[model samples]
Every structure is written in structure tokens, then in C-alpha cells.
Target chain A: MRNLVVLWMLILSMSIMAQMRDFQVITPELTGTLRLGLIRQNESLWLSDYKKIAAKKNGTETIYTIKHEWLNKGSIRISTKPLLDTHGFVMKIETTDIPASIHLFWAFGGCLGEVINLTGDENSLKPEFCKDNVFSIEGNSFTVYYGTSRKLRILEALVPPDSDVRLSDAHQQQTPLSFFNSGKKNDAPALAALTPLKNNEAVYFCFYKQNPKADYNYFMLPELYKKGSYEVHSETQWMKSTPD
Target chain B: MFKPLLIICFALFVGMYIKAATYNVKDFGAKANGKNIDSPAINAAILEAEKNGGGTIYIPAGEYLCYSIRLKSNITIYLESGATIVAAFPGAGKDEGYDAAEPNPDNPYQDFGHSHWQNSLMWAIGEKNITICGSGLIYGKGLTREESRLPGVGNKAIAFKECHNITLRDISMLRCGHFAVIATGVDNLTITNVRVDTNRDGFDIDCCRNVRITDCSINTPWDDAIVLKSSYGLRYFKDTQNVTISGCYVSGFDNGTAYTAQWETDEPQAPDHGFTVGRIKFGTESSGGFKNIAITNCIFERCRGLALEVVDGGHMEDLVISNITMRDIVNAPIFLRLGARQRSPKSTPIGAMRRININNINVYNADSQYSCIISGIPGHCIEDVSFSNINIYFKGGFTEEDGKRVVPENETVYPEPWMFGTIPASGFYVRHARKILFDNVRFHFAEKDKRPLFIFDDVEKSDISNIRVNGIKVENPFTAH
Candidate 1:
């Protein structure tokens, strides 16, 4: 009976940890549990202005399809599929009614630590991060964010290829949740402006619980044979074996 | 009327023939879905192109798992974007893997990988006007990084021997075993816009002439990025001459991280338990020599720095280097060694090192354990080397005892900086050298260091001027013998 109780307590702790890591919409404005916010501009439509049209499961993926009516002309449809394995999500927006711009804002409780822009630069040895919490991603396709909190969390945003998208850290003034609540309780949120998506487009955002480890053998190359399996012949031996 | 009809017929025939010159690998029964071995199909395409007096073998966008793709003369292998050639592992049987390493009678002097060229993913011997280009990837996923006599194992990614008029451009390589590209006894080589993130050496230009390497980014955490060698593997003393390397970036990042753009910095040390060894160097295998080489506008990051060595029995001369910048250097920013580790036949004498000019170098966050070393053997001295307009910043916390440490002359050993521990100088250490000049050189230390700025032992006819240490002017024109 005592061992059963210990096992139950272990299961309870695991459940609590998993729940804490789960990303969900915390506010009506679609503020994620990890402080990721979505804002649609050109009259500023939030998730609260949208209506959930459908939710379905498709092959190990739960996709939520939502729609927002803008100016009573047409409704924009957004399909968000959470990638459980990668701890990320892909949002596909399809509509003829294109907004002026869409942006993903991060309200990290004003605890943004470091931001690194990795684009065409592939020199891993000398990586340069932003200084003084100020960064510009003018010509970058990807960016990584780290929080100053003790929790080991990282956020990455990647722009889709061949898209007319620009990533920036500019401030967005749309809603109250778009502002970071520092200890002072009022600060501008870090913003990434992905402007002018076409009729159908998608973007990916990954919030990792921990830093991803680099895979040394990413292709799974085979190991070499042991040293004892072969003998290295010397010059004298090779010369003797050859016919002069 | 008959003559006009014959001319029209000939024009039509030529147009059709030109259109048939392109051989697509997919049309030749290559299942490029990363499943089946596609080397046989690729080789068949190459043979067909060669039979038609040379043509282009086009590989479209897919993953092709291959064993060995033999190269032929007058043929070009063009890979389209999103095309990847993955090296396939050898099955457990004889002749089940890549082509066997052909027997090399002149294999006594060099290592096994250098002695043979057949046992590789792609190889060419005695082929001219051959080119491999296009924005594709060569992933050595099944090649071994070790020297093994196993029947079904391959080592090198691309190995060329005795070839000429070669061009390799716009290709990216990852995790290439032993070497990403090794060109031996080849002439008129041009490599540009090639990116390689590998475990071992990136490019080994040995016994070649008229080589140009431009705009290459190579990252090798455990080995040299680009090393020029003149080994006796060809069984002849052919000097590597008239080479130029410019606009290159080399680094010692973890393998594959450069491609993925992750930039993981936790692992500061290499797997070999030495300092990360990704830098530009010349010779630990100088059997013939290097001449008329120029390197300019290069960058080094988180690795060793420029190393010019002629340890084997050869002559290294008439070299010029300019416009180099380094950051987070793990060892000496400049190492020039002329030693007597002659790994040649019985009658070969010691090599010579002279006539090297280096200018406009800047280094930051360098290790204080080793200063810039300019060393030679006891009886032989390196001659006529000059350094100008150089600046270096070191992470320093050395004591007086560390400054008084004695350096050993490992004459017959391999040439590397860490072979001698804790050099006594914090700026420069000179031994057995002559006609050396340091002009407008400056050194700065992050922490307190007790070593002198310059230490000379057996140095003759050296001129040091406009040298500063920690923003303070040192003795001007410090000359010693």
C-alpha cells in the first residue's frame, strides 16, 4: 500500500510538470502561456475578435481553424497546427482579405536576455549576439530569443522562404497584451514584423523548453573498424613484397 | 540544288546532337529517393557522356545514396539545387562498398589516405577539364574517418590524382570523412564558393600548381581547414607553386553546427583533446615545397591562427600574406617553424624556410600560453621573414615562473604550437632565426602578465620598431642577436 502511494505521487508530479510546459491561449487576445502574442494590423484584429469555426484531428496533429470578419467583406481563415514533437506550431493563414501586416510579439515580462540573428551567416565559431537588448533583423531569416529568467527556455522564429516577409524587433501598439509587464508593469513588447503575407502563407514558431543539443553524427555515419583488424605495413615490408 | 540540301541536313543534325549531349542520371535508372544505391546509375551516365566525347551529367533535385562516382575527363557533373549525394555504407562483403584503394607503389612516405585515391566517394585520376559544380551538397554519411584496411569502408569524399584543369564550385559538404577534398599532383585548379563543415581537414592541396581558392567557408573543429602540402606520395619532388587563397573564412566550430546555424558554444575543446585546429597552414608534409603563394583577406574564428611550417625536406619560400583578422584564437596567432623532421628517403637533406612577408594582421582574445613563435632547428635558421602592422590581444594571467619557462626543440617531431609548452614571451618568441623584422606591432593583455614582450634566443639581424605593450611604447628598434 505504501509503495502504491509513492508511485501515485511520482505520477502527480510528472503531470504537473507537463501541464506547466503546455502552451495555451491565456488571454482573449491570444497571448500564449509562454508570452507569445499574435496581432493582426490594419484596424487591429485580435483573437478575441475571431470566432472558432472548427477543430479537428489529422494524423497525430490537432488543427484549429479560426476566422475573423474584417469590414464585412470577407473572413480570413487561420489554421494552426501544433507540432508536439518539436514543441512548435505552424499557422497557415488563407484569405483574399490580406491585412496590412501581421506580427508575433513577445511579452517576456520585460526579461528579454539575449537575441541572436542567424541568417546567411554560418560561422558558428564567432557568433555575435545583440548588445544591450537591442537588435535589428533587417536582413535575417531566423532569430532566437532567450529569457533572463532562471527557467531554461528558448524561442525561435523562422521566416518562410520566398515570402515577402521582414523580421524586426520594433514595438507594436495594438492591444494591452502587446506590452511587456516589467516590474514597473508597463513596457513595449518585443515584436517581429512579418508583413504582407500573400493569400496563402504559413509561419513557424518554436518554443523549446531547453536548448537543443547539436548532433555531431547527424547522418549516422558508420564507425570505423578497430585498429587490431588491420596491420599497417612499413616501407621495408612493402618494398620486399614488390618485384624489382 | 544538291549542295543546298546537304548544308541544311548538316545543320539539323548538329542541332539534334547538341541537344543529346546532356545525360540526366534519373533517365539512366537512378532511384534518387535516398533508398537504393545510385552509384551504378551515375557511373553509367558518366560513361555514356564520356563515350560521346564528354558532356554534362545532370543530377536533379533528390537525395542520391551512392558508393563511388568515378569521374572522367571532359565531363561536368552538375547538381541542381536540393540535390544531395549521400555516401552509402558498405555491406558486409567483399567488393560491397566503394572501389578498393588501388595499390600505390609510392605509398611509403605519406599516410594511407594520401597514398590512395580510389577508395573514396568520388575520385578522378589523370582526367583533364573536369568540373563539379552547382549548389548541391555532398554528405559523407557512410565514410570512415579512420585509416582502416576494411574491405567495405571508404575515407575521402573527393580525391583527385594527377588531374589538370579542374574546377569545383558552388558545392557544400558536411561531415566529410578523412578529407573533404584532396588534390594531389594536379595543376590549374580553381575552387570557389565551396562551403565545407567537416570533421577532418577541409582541403589538402598537395603537389599542385596554379591553384586558386576564393570565397570558401570551412569549419573543422578537430583539424586544419586548408593545408598546402608537397608530399612524396607522388614519388617525385614537384613543388606546389603559384597558389592564391583570398576571401576565405575558417573556423573551429563543432561539426555540422555551421550548416544548421545553431552555434552551440558549450564545447570549447576539440575531440582530440587539443586546441581547436581550424586554420590555414602549410606543411607538416613538405617533401617537395611551396613557392609563390599569396593569401589575403582571410578571417579565423575560435581556432588556431596562421601556421607556416616546412618540417620535411623541402623549401618554402616567396610567400606573402596580408589582411588577416582573428578572434578568440586558442593558440599562437602566428607560428613559423623550420625543423628537421625530414620524413623522406635517406638522402634528402633538411628543408629551408625563407622570404615570407606578412602584414596587416589583427588578433583578439588569444591564449597567453603561447606567443607568436618563430623557430628553427639548432643548425638551420629560418631567414628573411617580416611582420608589419600587427596587433594582438591576449587573455593573460601568467606569472614570473611561467615567463622563465624553457622551451624544448622537438626537432624530429610533428610541427604544432602546443608541442612546446608555455613559451616564455607574451608577444613574440624568436629562436634560431635571422633577418626577422617586426614593424608597428602592438600587444595588449586582458589580465596581468609577467612575461616580456619579446624574447630572442639565437636570433640574428632582427629589427623591431614601433612596438607597444598595453598602450605604452616599448623600446624602439629593439635588435638582438
Candidate 2:
């Protein structure tokens, strides 16, 4: 009975801590060159204001949706839905107005994953290999390793037409997108276009992990991998998906 | 009465210990979603930590969009491996961006960018014993790269001013708007194992003392990768002294692609004439002197060569560079200049540069025409410089006429290799200097050249030993002084 009381007290404290600090979990995994659509409603608008607006937990999967607004001009939305059984996620993008050009720039070392490969949306866009990717780091690989074990692989899914991606350097001096070719890894964070915004014009992109399953824990969420399983396992089961 | 006082003292000591607690930003109403601006919660957590006489603020693996994270002394922000602190873009509302750049009455002396520090994603002013460490990322997504003062644009990733005992380690910055890290008037700084691959300047250690930067990799195509400056940003002649930069690599690659081993392609697009302004430099801003500096065991690739300048009235002394390697150099392999641009106080005179020792440098595929140059102003000559065990390979296609070309004395112009306009010497051009020595140095060219390897003008007390041209011992590889 005394042991049961101790266990109950521990549970009570845990619940209290969770209730006290209910900050939302922002996805740090998606980084580097972001995608923004240029649209014209009244004047010219670029969907540069990107922010995560909502997050929902279903089963072992969490879905995060980001909204992009062009300064009271227009709105666009994107969502990252993690898969319950794989190291992958589905990205759904919705456009409101037509954008002129799309620009993409990959960050040299960021959380988007190592050895990224993109598929989906009919594979209309393909990245080329570049040779100028050389850097030196101490006690780690030159390529940034994400997560605790650093085994996550970021895979791209879709690329819309009228898309152009390039490698740009130098702050304050804008390098034209024509300077670089579409390369993979840090070289190829590509941009795509969603022109002629019409009703119900939604596109899909999937950035899933391939052939990587590791169990680890970090300070922010130490209980994430507490089960020591490579698969997603959570005691707090949530709804997998709800009809819209 | 004594027993009561002792008890009270013990209680107070214990209370102090209890107050120093670990504050998690999430607990203080910080939503880790990449959308919400959580600067207030994070700042509150920091305030709570500060109130407790300094503590650790732990941020877990998640995306946190923040607007300006003001720092405090004696506080350590430990980001879990997957955690990221992202800067928010403008257009949220008015009064949202970083506090506009601090107004400096001494602004005209420097560029508009160098005069301020408050317009940044993360800034600390007049703090001490501060550290921002972890395997986390600082993504300057919404930060602007504009040099001019735009009230709504955030320019820098991390800026520290007038702080001491600063330690920045294991942080990766991407596309930092203007500069990845800018620390001015900071003392006793140790920045190690930091990776910066961005669009602009990497690490600008300005007006600092007792700085040790090691094991850092900076890949910036448009600006100096790692620079040491002594600007009048502090409005004084505080010297940058006792600095050591070792075990570092500076390279120029396409933006967003360095070290991932991806994007490996033939005929890769070169950035700006296949020459990146990526090099290690000292003082484009030299209001204060630089002394007791050493740069060793470093590598430079696909970029401009090493530049050491004292153009703005600042005395530089006791500098040593050794064990350096270079590849795919597009311009001169080395440039040492002592000029009289004199952007310092009117009372300050032209600076003096002396006692520079360079050893064990190897270069491959250097531009043959531009070659290496060490020049001083007409009257103010560089003194007591020596080079040993240096081997350089050039893409030589120069004729005797190219060798006889008289490089102009554009002393006041910005000190750059191309500024001299294709020097005559295929190996080195020494002018307006004294006590110069070259021992065991060889200059190799891909194509045979008619010009002598070295040129000397207005040189005094020159000593050359074991000099070779295309692997053959020449009677005098240096001539036409």
C-alpha cells in the first residue's frame, strides 16, 4: 500500500508538471530554405510570413500545419503529418493566389536530414549533384547529423513546375538564382511554383525517412523513446485521423 | 544570540542553493511550434533563472520561433540536440523586430552595419560569463541581410557587445542574415567547434582581447570567413590583442551546400568567377592595433588568399602564420599591406606593421598573373617579415612583359589582390619593405614563363636562400628591383 501511494504521488507530480508547462512543440527538424509563393491579389504579395499555427496528436503521430500569409494580402497553408510507423511525414500545401517565381536555397548544415532524396508529385523536379560542398568540422561529420543518434534521413516528395532552385552565398549581396544548378544535400533546396490560385488547388509533398530506425532520448523530451523501440509507441493514444 | 544568527545564515545559504533552479522554457508558456513568437516566454524563463542568481535554461528538441532573445549574465542556454531557435520574419506587427540598431554618434566612421548590435536575433550587451552551447541550430529564416538600417529587418544571428568571458560552442548557424556571429569589445572569448555556412560574414571578432578560436569551419562565399577587426564601433582605441586561430578551415562553396557530401557534380557552378571572397583577414577596420596574433594549422580552399592589412592607422606587431595549406586559389596566395587609408582618429598617424613570420605554407592552382604581394606605402615600409618552407603552384601563362608590368600604388583603395592589377612577379612581389627573408621557397608553374619568379622594388636588406623556379636552381630568381 505504501508503494502504491508513492507511485500515485509520482503520477500526480508528472501530471501537474505537464499541466503547468503546456508549451506547444514546434518542429525543429524542418529547416533551411523555405518555400514561399508569390501571389497577386490587389498588389504584389509574397507568402513570406510562414508560421506553425496548429498541431494535433493522433495515435503516435503528430500533425503540424504552418500558415503563410503575405502581409494582409493573401494566405497559404502547409502541413507536416508524421507517420506512425515510419520516419516519414506527409506535407500538404494549399495555395490561395498565383505566385510569380519560387526560390529555394538549402542550408549547409541544418536539421532537414542527411542524404536527402525527394519523390512524389510525379517527380517533376530532380536535383543534380554539386562538387563545391566541402567543409571541415571537429569531432563530427561535415554533414550535420540530426536527432540524438543522427540517423534521420530527409526525403523530398513533390516539386511543382515553374520551380527553380540554386545555391546562394554572401550576405547583403543577392546572387541571382541563375548562378547555381539544382543539387542535392546542402546544394539543392529547391523552390516550386503554384501559379494561378484557384479554389481547391492543393498540392501534396511527402518528406519521409527511409531505412532509418533508432531509439534515443534527449533532454527536451526524455520520455520520447522510453519504450526503447524503434517504432512509435505511446501510452496516450490519440485519434489517428478525423474526417474534414 | 550567536546560535540564532548561525541558524539564519545556514538557512540563507540553503535558500540560495534552492533558488538556483533549472528553468525549462516550455514550462514558462513557450510553445515549441515553429510559428508562435515565444520570445516572451523564453525571456521570462531567463528572468526567472536570473532572479535565482543564475541558472540553466533548457530548451528541448523542437522548433521555437523567437523575435529577440535578450541574454543575461551567468546564464547558460542549453539546447537539446534537436532543438532549434528560429528567428521570426517581419510583418507580425509593429514593435516586433529587434530593437533598431543602437544609435552611435560615431556611426560615420564605420559602415552602417558595424555600428549596431541590437538589431539581431540574439544579443547581449554588458554581460559576463555567458555561454550559448549545444548541438542545436540557429536558423535566421526571417532575418534580412540588408546592410542599411531597416527598422523592421533583423540582420545578425548572434551579437555580443562589451561582454567578457563569452563561450560559444557547438552551434550551427544557417543563412544568418548578415553575420553569423559578431562580438565587439568582448574579452576572454572562446569560440570552438562552431559551424557557420551562410550568405555573409561568418565570425567577426572585433576589438576583442584574449580570444581563442579553434576547430571552427566557416563557408561564406561573399565575405571574409573569419575576420579580426578593430573598428571604432566602441568609440575608442581598444586594441585587439593576444588572439590565436588554429585548426580552422575556411572555404567557398555554393550557398546552402558545404560538407554534406551531397551536391557533388561535375562542372559545378562557381560563385562569382569561381572566386569566393572567402579568406582569413585582419582589419578592414583597424582603428586599434593588433598584437601577438598567431594563425596556424588552417586550410583555405576555393577562395581568395590570406590578407593582412593595417590600412587604418593601427600598429600591428608580432604576427606568426604557419602550417597552412590552400587549393584552387583564384588570386594571389598571400597579401600583406601597410597603407595610409587612415580611417582612424585624425590625431592617429599611419600604422606600422612589423615582425610577421610565415612558415610551412603550400598552395596549389594559384593564379599566375596576380601572384603573392607584400607592399607598403611609399615611405612607411613593412619591416622584419620572413617566409620559410613555402611551395606554390601557379597556372602560369605570363610573358616577360607581364613580369615588367609596374603595379600601381593604389594605397588608399580597398586592399585586395586584384586592386594591385596583375603584379609582375610569378612568385612574390616585395616592395617598400625592409629585412625580408625567403628561405627554402619554390614556385612551380604549369606552363613555362619568361618572367623572373620574384620582383623587388624599394626593398632593403633582402635575403633569399634555396629559391627554385620550375624545380631548377636559378642564379637569381628575383630581379628587376
Candidate 3:
């Protein structure tokens, strides 16, 4: 009987560990390396200042929730998961309150060599080699290829239907991402200013390191994180948990 | 002189015999009371008429509660001015309801209401040269508006399948169940001066050909007023061709109010929580196609606008819509979509939409959230569409922020304006189209809106001239590659 009990406990622990492998709590160290904030009334509120409350595992993603008392009377949750068959990650930003704007700034140390706008105007496919410039996208989605030293990073961002998108240098202290440190002049971090989200709305962003030899399917990347798979939990679930 | 006199006498005798073939339900023991089920007596009269090689079945002024009134070919059901046929409720005993819904092996493609013909207040199958006329009322008091498989629940007021040369005129329907009239695979059908104040779809003309629907007043707050569909309910693909709907009035008023002219607004929303859906549309179910259709001189009040959708693996071509005026429009004034729902057999290909011409339209108090959308899927572009002499006034409050929103390529989902939330443009949003033209079009907003008048994405060979916004002339506003 003692041996059988030990085997049962071992099996239960192994199953729990297997389930836990699908989720990873985003630590403070990881959040520090990234710049994220909300832009409201032409002011940038950094995510670093938000109080991290709880981290929960939901399906194939890990949800990290953070709240601000005076922002919009609700919390902001960031759910992220790595791509199953690729070397990238998809992150989604969902809010419980309606903000003036939801912004994301991705800093890549130095200025990108070339910016290739895929879904733009007649000037699409024309390479622009600029360090600190902002490009106005006419549509709600921006799919761009950034060239660096011996590597190409592809990023695709999708906002709510009918919203606009902008790709700008992170060094410029704009209303969207001004709270982040204004790096040196050569730092051209991509900033996407999504339109203000309604309560319980979400925006998705994906980043991938392209393989030089293989053909990259640009259109299929967004389908990896389709909106139907992302579940929006009730605000009461997050409100009931005590702040860490 | 004797032979000529004999021939004249014989002709007079035959004429008099032909004139005496009118069968009356009251003579067949129908009481015409409001309580008793009079369908057996009515059916007996119909049988007597049919036995004499078809004649007129006359129903005079009275209220008759009935169950299923089976219809035969070569018969005319004529009702007098005050005649009303009320649908009776199904009873709990065995074999006590309307005729059991006939088993249809092709029931997979369409809804349950479209698949069955026997479970109705009146039904005709494979019949021809049938006419139902006279100013009378058909009040479906006990039919169900919902789709069900229960033993004793009838859904359609009148259903005809595979019938030809059918005419329904000068009749009124009230509180009809799933559909006021559903005609599938019916050809040479004519409906004129028919009024319907119903709970669900007023008319579903499906898989039909050579149809003429004119001078009708239809009010359906919960569903479509007059919709033309080509569903695969007949187990075969057929086109709804040579159709004309002219001089009709469609509205989304409360049930039983349009006939009374009250126009009540107490029920602001439909059961689906969307705005009231009462408009002329084509094909939520289109397995076959639509061709040579023309709609002219239609008035819409307090309802959604004209929608032309070909989602299910079918082709829509050669349509001309003109002389339309709308007030208190709820959604897009004109929505055209060529989607790839592919709700047919696995061998069917995606559908196509082309060669549509619309002109001389005036709309007032339109919703600002959705623009007049004309969208097609990625590879399948809507081809050769033209709009001329159009004027629309929108209730606009869209800011610059609203214009920046994205529109998803809902390739296979149900097509509706609200499927994509707020459109980026205030006036017109055209995407994935080819060879489009706009001339003498004006857009006026009641309030200030910051979005552009037009937004075109992936469109080719577009021609724009004489376009005005708020009385100010504007050039081609914005185009995305």
C-alpha cells in the first residue's frame, strides 16, 4: 500500500509539471527589458509603474495582469506565448477599461538598416534608410521587415478594426511612448500607436526572426494568434485576487 | 335549319354547366365560426372542386379557424372582403397537428423551415396554375416563428415547392410564423398588392425563376421583409433569374402596425439585439445563382438598407437597381459583398459577383458607424460596379481615431455591416474591387466627422467624377495599395 501511494503521487506531480510547462510567469527582469505604456490625452503612462497582481495560465498562453489605481478603474493584462513552429512570440494587450490609446514601443538597440513597408501606398516596397523618422500607415495593420546586421526581423501588428497605425523611432519622445528612456540618436525603436481601445478590447503584436533561406509567409503569421483563440476572462476574476 | 338549331342549343347547355362549378365551403358543412376547426370542411370543398376537374372554391365573409389546408393544382381559392382564415393551434393527441413535416433527404443545406413544406398553414407541392386572391386576411395565430422539430409545430404560413404559374394577390398576412410565404423551386410566380405584417421573414422566394413582386407593403421588425434566395433545398442547383421587384414599400415597424398605419417605435431592437432588420436582400443561402434582376422605385423607412450578398458558392450578375429613397436607415444604405462561405457540396467553387448598376438613390438619417460597403475577398474581386446620382446624409460623429481602425477579411463568416465595427470611411468603403465608377455622388453629414469621404483598398481602374461632400467638391480621397 505504501508503494502504491508513492507511485500515485509521482504520477500526479508529473502531470502537474507537464501542464505547467505550457505557461511561464513573466518576471520583472523580462518586463524591464521592454518598454510598454498607455497613451491617454497625449500623455504616456509606462507599464513599469503598474502594480503586478497575478499571473495565470490560460490555454497555450500566460497572462500577466497589472493595474493602476487612478488610470481607468480597471486592470491591463498582457498575454504572451511563443510560436509553436517558429522562433518568435505573439503578445496581446487587453484592458478592462477604455483608455485614450494603447501603445507599444519595441527598442532594438540601434537603428534598423532598412524598413520595408508591405501594406502601404504606391511607395510600398521602397526601402527607406532613416534613423529617426515616423511613417504613417493608412490602414489598421502594419507588416514591416527591419534589416539589421546579418539578420532580418519581421514584425506584424494588428489593432481593432478601423484603427490606424504608425511606425516611428523610439528615441522620439512622442505621446505614445515618451515615458521610455530617450535612447541615443541612432536608436530607432518601432512604436505602434493603436487607437484607444474600448473596455475588454485587445490588440495583437507578433515578432519573428526570419530564416534567410526559407520563404516567409507574411499573411499567415497573424493567423497564428487569431482573435477567436484568445479568451477574455471577466474583470471580476482579476479583481478578486489580492495584489502581489 | 334543324341541325343549326341543335348546335346552338348544345353550346348554351355546355356554357351553363361550366359556370355552375363554383364550390362553396359553407355548403360543405363549414360553420365559419371563430372557434371550431374548419379545415376538414374546407378540404372537402377543395376535393369536391378538384373532382370536377378543377373549379373555384369560394369563401365568403366570415372567420374560419383551420389546420393545414392542402392545396391542389388548377384550383382558385377566392375569398370575399371580410373573410379571414385563422391558423388553429396544434393539439396534444396523436396525429392532431398540421401534417407531419415530410422527410427531406436534402435537409442539410438549408434551415428546417425551408426544408419542410407540409408542416404549414397551407402547402402545395408539384402543383401548377393555382391562384389565391381576393382581399382577405390570413392570421397565423398558432404557428411557431422558431425552427423546431417538435411533433405539432407549424412554421410557415404558406409554402409551395416545385410549383409553376402561381399567383398570390390582394391578400394580407398577420403575425406569420417563420415566413409569410416561402416558395422554393417555384417558377413564373407573381405576387402583387400583398401586405404582410409578420414576426419573421415576410417572403422567402428561393430557387425560383421569372418572379414578379410588385406593389407590396411588408413590415417585419424581426427579420427581412422581402428576400430572394437560392438555397439547395430542392437537392439541385438552380438560378433565381429574371426577377423584378418594383414599387414596393418595406419597413421595420412593430408587428401588426404597418397595416394599421400606427408606426409604433416601442420595440427598438430585434430579438438578435441588432437593429431591426427589414430590407430587401439576396442570398444568405445561395447555392445556385441570381441573374437578370432589377429593382426599381422602392421606398424604405425605419429599416436597414438594400443588401446584395452572394456568400455560398454562387454567381450574381446583371443587376440594375434604381430610384430608391430611404429614411431613418439603420445600417449601411447599400452593402454588396462577394464572400467565400462555400455552404454547398464539397465540389462547389467560390462564388462571383459582377456587373451591378445602381443609380438615383437618396438616403437620409443613415447610421454613421458603417459606411456603404462594397467588399470582395482577396482573389475574387467584385467586377464592373457603377453608382451614379446618389446622395446620402449620415448622422456622423466619427472622430479621426475611428478612421484608423482595421477591417478584417472575414472571408467565411456571415456577412453583415456590423461584423466589422466602425468603418474607417464615413461615406464609402470599397475593397478588393475592380473597374468601379462613381459619378454625381454627394455625401452630407448632420454632424462633423473627420474621416474621409471615401476609402478604397486594393481597387483597380476606379473612375470618380462630380463627387461632392457637404456641398464641397472633393477629389479622390484615399487609396491603399
- Using lDDT as the measure, the top candidate is 3
lDDT of 3: 0.71
Clashes by residue pair, model 1: none
TM-scores for every predicted model: 0.66, 0.67, 0.65
DockQ metric, candidate 2: 0.02
lDDT of 3 by residue, B1-481 (tens): 9999999999999987876678888998888888888888889988888888888889989999888999998899988799999887666455556887877666666777877898999999999889999999998977877433555657789999999999999999998888999999999999999999998899999999999999999999878999999988898999899999999999999667897888886455554445678899998888899999999999999999999999888899999999999999999999999998777778888898999999999999999889799999999999999999999999988988888889999898778887777899998899999999999998889988887778889899988888888888876655210
Off by over 4 Å in 1: A1-244, B1-15, B476-481
Candidate 1 accuracy as TM-score: 0.66
Q: Against the true structure, whose TM-score is highest?
A: 2
Q: Give chain A TM for each model in order.
A: 0.41, 0.35, 0.49
In lDDT terms, how accurate is model 1? 0.69
- DockQ-based class of model 3: incorrect
How close to the true structure is residue B240 of candidate 1, measured as C-alpha lDDT? 91
Fraction of true interface contacts that also occur in model 1: 0.00
Tens digits of lDDT, candidate 2, A1-244: 1100000111221112111111111133332232333333323322222223344444433333333443244444444344333343343455444243322221222233223433211111222321232222111111122332112222322233223323333121112222132233344323322233343465433333322242111110122222212342231022121100
* Candidate 1 residue-wise lDDT, A144-237, digit = tens: 3223212222333333333333222223324423232211111222333333445544443332211112111111111101110112223123
Please tell me what DockQ candidate 1 reaches: 0.02
